[model samples]
Target: MKKQKIFALILPVIALGGLLTLNALKADPPSKSKPAVAGLTVPTGFDINVIADKLGSARHLVITPQNDIYVHMASTRVSKGIVVLHEEGGKTTIKTSFANYGGTGIAMGGGYLYASDKSGVFRYKLDANNQVTNPENPDRIVTGLVSVDWHQPKAITLDNDGNVYVNIGAPSNICDELDKNRTGCPLLDSAAGIWQFRTDKLNQSYKEGVHYAWGLRNVVGITWNQQLNQLFVMQHGRDNLHQMHPKLFTEKQSAELPAECMFAIKKGDNAGWPYVYYDWQKQKNMLGPEYGGDGVKPADAKYINPVVGFPGHLAPDGLLFYTGNQFPERYKNGAFIAFHGSWNRAPEPQAGYFVVFQPFKNGKPDGKWEVFADGFAGTEELKAQGRAEHRPTGLAQGPDGSLYITDDNKGTIYKVTYKK
Candidate 1:
């Protein structure tokens, strides 16, 4: 069955073997009413400003040295797919839009702008201005990736080397087996892992990608730490902990069972999802419900551990290893994660609709994670997922040591800067 599935994934390469066809973005319509940044609260020296608003489905964003913004829209009502904003005179104006498909991966590297949809990955050659030279069509870099409704965001990151890493996220809850431990996963060969392709290569398929790392389950947020020269990924832990294993975990435990993890990935490294999940409360990796060990048993010694663990169901959306000299000296080399907010933490108030800063010393976490930016939801308490006024979606560091965050809910971009 696995062999047949693999073959089915590859047979479509011939049909999509060329540059992707795109519809150029129309000029951004006038902003009748922009969101106010007064609701946001940052550090003492920092101020947040709402730069852009009314962007539909703004999922991921990449900022250029010129301070221009490129946003990948998962679904849009005003524009096509990817929208570009040109920054000038303390204002960001919509310049153009390109690409027809909508999904969550966008990155700039090696003079190219890379973006992915549900299934395939594409790149456009960037001109000296850091703008796409050809917005109508782009080189199809990788094709034939799995694109089911589950775990199919295709979040991407590129190392300093020529490698481009794409997440082939797992489509099912724990690989389709709920009641028992399933070894080898069988799905490992097709999904639940990061596939490494070449930034310099074109028209490559899944068969061409090297399975760089596995057992990640779903990785929506990923970044390459240039200082440490390593790839770091944020894994969204498995959900429905108590509903799946009622005998062992309560609803509260289910809401916070497995830890949303941050991992420093190396070749052949695995975080042991499905069979196990890291328990932040226990400070150890515990066997998973499907694996027959309840929630407290220790996982096999063979699996690796997380570098940092966050509470369950935070839905961490973006990760950045702060390399720029922006902000205070303490922020240098730290990790900033944007939690898009949680939906499954029912019975307990939904948390994590803000950005967090985790300080690091010599490439490892040095202190407890702290909320760097808050008030995104605009309410004192969160009753449910979409109840928040704004949901933080993406994170970007600007050219001049500033942090730029995106809100997919209201399509607002907030620029945070510090002054002495």
Candidate 2:
């Protein structure tokens, strides 16, 4: 009877082992899926390949000197703020949550990657293999940046001296107090402008550096021109062209008013926000209705004028001064700006959903601006129902002298290189 009991127990143990072996054989290893196409159309000489996609609102991108692409992805649910993409043999591996904060800005300067969220800025150190292993805990480079209804994603740029410039957007449209459309009721106060800060230090308050430039309503795109050794920005003009003040501005006047400005910024420069507007139709800067000047005059000499102006509300988001030698000779030392396009320019079709090139000669605009790449706005049908496949928001240059453009609407990055 003891032998019978032993046999029964041995049988159960052998059966159990066999079952476990069968289950192990049934399980399969994880399979790799094919990468999806980005669905972007480019010119004949260029190709739009997706480095990364399906990220949560990938706003801005910057590449390191070693050819690694770092994307700042803003989150609404999961805060995977920054994502680093390493590409090898046409395969991309993504390392996410590189930073604790994420906003609409990412820049590489001083041998480190810097990013800004709604609150503050942070830095990271990349190794020789272009891998960011030690991401420093965030240091508030600048605080008290307005985070109200308007002006949320303050874009950031760095100068050669390691000074960081953050675009602090104004909270209100025209700083209107009563919301009743009165002239000169709201004034240009301390709240509406860009603020500069030092990147080498932490916890620097708004009062540390000078309030770099005033009267800039919302300069979203800021970059330092390495060729010129100067800072440049693309301004988002005031809204509600004729809806806010009808008596002062006609529909045609309102449609073509508020010239989007590109400024070569300097210390103590004021671009005149609430005090004046640039009228493209008149080809002159005019005083703002709030300041009681008619709509057909030149801007005040006390205020600095824009180096170049664009149509109203094109929403320039990405600006880059090309220093690469891969493209044609004319592209060298020039600027490429990506307009995010217009939303309020209704009754008239929306414009500026493409990349534009402005030639520069001797540190200034040498020729008229032209559309460098088109077909971003796929169709012209009003009230059509389809997703805007992409909206260009960031610009970066690859180590091979190719240009990289990123779209926020769909998280796709395109590397553009010249053929032949």
Candidate 3:
């Protein structure tokens, strides 16, 4: 009996050892049974390839001139919130992983690589090759940003001058105050907008930053248009229009009423939130139900309008302006947006699991937006059920003009190249 018990315990331990060895051998596991690019659809003459796989919550990424790719994760499980990749010959592999914190929004500017966690932005010194030399000891450029419950990721961008903008998202859905009457949304005093700070300043608090714009509920995708010399941002629209006010909006109307907007931002600009939402169907901004409009009343004219509006709840997460010569002339200076897909369009099929291209001319949108890449959800049924195998989360352009996309679901990285 003593030998029998000892044998059983050894058997279980042996099995566990085998399992761990197997997992260790398979460092890069496939996300699905199907090939990574099996269902992907891109425009003609453009082909897509999976450069890396199984990255784990890859959020935003930036590519250096030397072709080194740095991907940020929402968590630290896989790469400890940051993964640096390098490609040699035909294979791309993780060169190293660093950073103790993970969130989103990474960019390269002013000879430094800037990355943000939920509460602050940090920067690492780059060497002559544009590679981070001091990942272990990054400088805390800006600190003390607000983050509570919802809309907390501090998506960041930098301007040509010396300014860095960080998005301080609001915590409320509509600032409803639990259905109680309120005069004004006090949350707007500190959140729901973008704040600008000097890049040269280190360890700056929220009090030292200046409010660049106000009343923008949450902005994740922000960029500076080099062609136009203007700042652009993608605003996540409010939700639960029908559930909050069923008498005013039907389920279908709620699913498609408020449009996700792209705004050309300027100092003092206010894309009204908790008070109005842009109705793409009506081509007008409508008053929010929380702020005393039944759905048909137009919002006050003082509220600025978006440069372009898209279907609601699509969740625009990344934006990049293409200035690469690798593509045809038609793509020059166009905007590429990655929609992270939606989860809230219940009672209706969820939409937006692809990347889109918006044509631009003379520093403004000149044509309608078109689907540039698709098949991210894996299947039609999966998309309808809001179960995505992989969702595009961030975009970066290589020095050679190749476009790189990151998937947050499975940590997949895709590279798109144009061939004539």
Ranking by lDDT: 3, 1, 2
TM-score of every candidate relative to the true structure: 0.90, 0.84, 0.92
Model 2: per-residue Cα lDDT over 87-174, one tens digit each: 5555554544455565888887665677887755676665666666576564456666557656778788998888888887777777
Tens digits of per-residue lDDT, candidate 1, 134-211, equal 888899999988888988788998888888899888887776463243555877778888889999888888778898
| Model 3: CA > 4 A from native | 1-34
In candidate 1, what residue range of length 10 has the lowest lDDT sum?
1-10
Write one digit per residue (lDDT tens) for candidate 3, span 1-420.
011100000001011223222133234544433366455888877877777776678888999887788998998766576778776455665666678988998988888989999898999888898888898999998898887868888899999998899999999888886347756788887899999988888998778899999889898888989988888999999999999899999999889868999999999998888888999988898889888898889999999999899999999999999999998899999999999999988888999989999999988889799999888888799999999898998999999899998999977788888887
Residue 287 miss distance in model 1 (angstroms): 0.8
User: How accurate locally is residue 16 in candidate 3, as Cα lDDT from 0 to 100?
Assistant: 26
- Please report how far candidate 1 places residue 385 from its true position, in Å: 6.0
- Per-candidate Cα lDDT values, in order, are 0.80, 0.68, 0.83
Sort every candidate by TM-score, greatest first. 3, 1, 2
Clashes of 2: 1
* RMSD of each candidate relative to the true structure: 9.8, 13.8, 9.6
